[model samples]
Target: MASKIAEAELDSVEKVFAAQEAVPSWKDQLTFRSFVIGFLLTILITFIKVKVSLNTEIIPSLNVCAGLLGYFCLKVWTQCSSQLPFTRQENSVIQTCVVAGSGIAFSGN
Candidate 1:
C-alpha cells in the first residue's frame, strides 16, 4: 500500500516537473527577494536590540532569551516566505516556534 502511494506521488511530481520545464523564462531565481528579506530582518533585529537595551528593567537573562527568540522569529519569517530552501519538515519546525513565540512576545508587550 505504501509503495502504491509512493508511486502515485512520484507520478504527480513528474507531471509538475514537466510543466515547470515547459514554462518560458520564469527566472526561477530568488536572490533579490532573499537579499531584501535578509536586510529587513537584520534591520529589525538591530532596532529591537537597541530599543530594548535602553530599558534595563528587563533581566539580563530575559534580554538574552528575547534576542534568541527574535533570531528564531526572523528565521521563521524568512523560511515561511521561501527566503531559504528547506524541506517541509524543516519549515514546520521553524514555523511552529515562530507562531508560539510571536504570540508570547506580542501578548507580553
Candidate 2:
C-alpha cells in the first residue's frame, strides 16, 4: 500500500540519519597540506584566467573550474593515501581563495 511504502521510506531515512550521526566527523583543523594545495590551485587558476582573458573577450568560469579542480584533487588524494581526504569545507575554502585570486588578476588587466 502507499501508506506502507511511505512508512518504509521514512524508516529508511531515519536509519540513514542515525548512521551518519554515529560516524565521527573529520577534525575541522586546517592542515598544512590543504593550505599549500589551495594556494597553488589559486595561483594556477588565476594564471589560466589571465591567459584566457588576454586571448578572448569571453571570461572563463572560475567557480566551475575551482569546483572541478577541488573535486579532482580530493579524489586523487583519497586514492593515493590511507588518510582522510579533504572535506567539503576545505573544498569551499579552496574555491573561495581561487575566486578571490582570480578577481584580483582580472582587475589588474
Candidate 3:
C-alpha cells in the first residue's frame, strides 16, 4: 500500500513538474501598499465580524467580504494613483492576509 501511494505521488509530482513555468518573484508582490491595505482591511473585517457575532448568531464569510472589499478599495486606489496597476494576484494576497488576520483577531476575542 505504501509503495502504491509513493508511486501515485511520484506520478503526480512528475506531471506537475513538467507543466511548471518560471514562477514570478514574490518580492515584487510584497509592496508597501499591499501591507497597508491588508492591515487596514484586517482591522475593519475583524471589527465587523466581532460586532456581527455579538449581535447575531451568523458570522460573515471572511473571504468573500475581504475579497470584495479589497478589490473595490484597490480599484479606487489605482484610480487615485496612476503609478501602480492592481493585479489579480496582489488582490488575492491582500484578501488572504485580511482573512487570516481577521480570523486571528476574532478568535482572540
Best model number under TM-score: 3
Where does candidate 2 stray beyond 4 Å? 1-29
Give the per-residue lDDT digits (tens) of candidate 1, residues 37-89: 33444445445544565676442223344445545655676767766552233
Q: What is candidate 2's lDDT per residue for 43-80, written digit by digit as tens?
A: 89888888887789677877988878877887787789
Predictions: Cα RMSD each: 11.7, 4.3, 6.9
Instruction: Show where candidate 3 strays beyond 4 Å.
Output: 1-23
TM-score of each: 0.32, 0.68, 0.74
The whole-model lDDT of each prediction reads 0.47, 0.75, 0.85
Best by lDDT: 3
Q: What is the lDDT of residue 98 in candidate 3?
A: 98
User: With candidate 3 superimposed using the best TM-score fit, by how many Å does residue 39's alpha carbon deviate from the native?
Assistant: 0.7
Q: What's the residue-level lDDT of 67 in candidate 2?
A: 74
Candidate order by TM-score, highest to lowest? 3, 2, 1
**How far off is residue 90 in model 2, in Å?**
1.3
Model 1 local distance difference test score: 0.47
lDDT string, candidate 3, 27-108, tens digits: 8667778778999999999999999999997878779889998898888998999867876678888998998999888878
Name the lDDT of candidate 2: 0.75
- Between candidates 1 and 2, the TM-score winner: 2
Q: In model 3, state the lDDT of residue 86.
A: 74
- Candidate 2: C-alpha RMSD to true structure equals 4.3
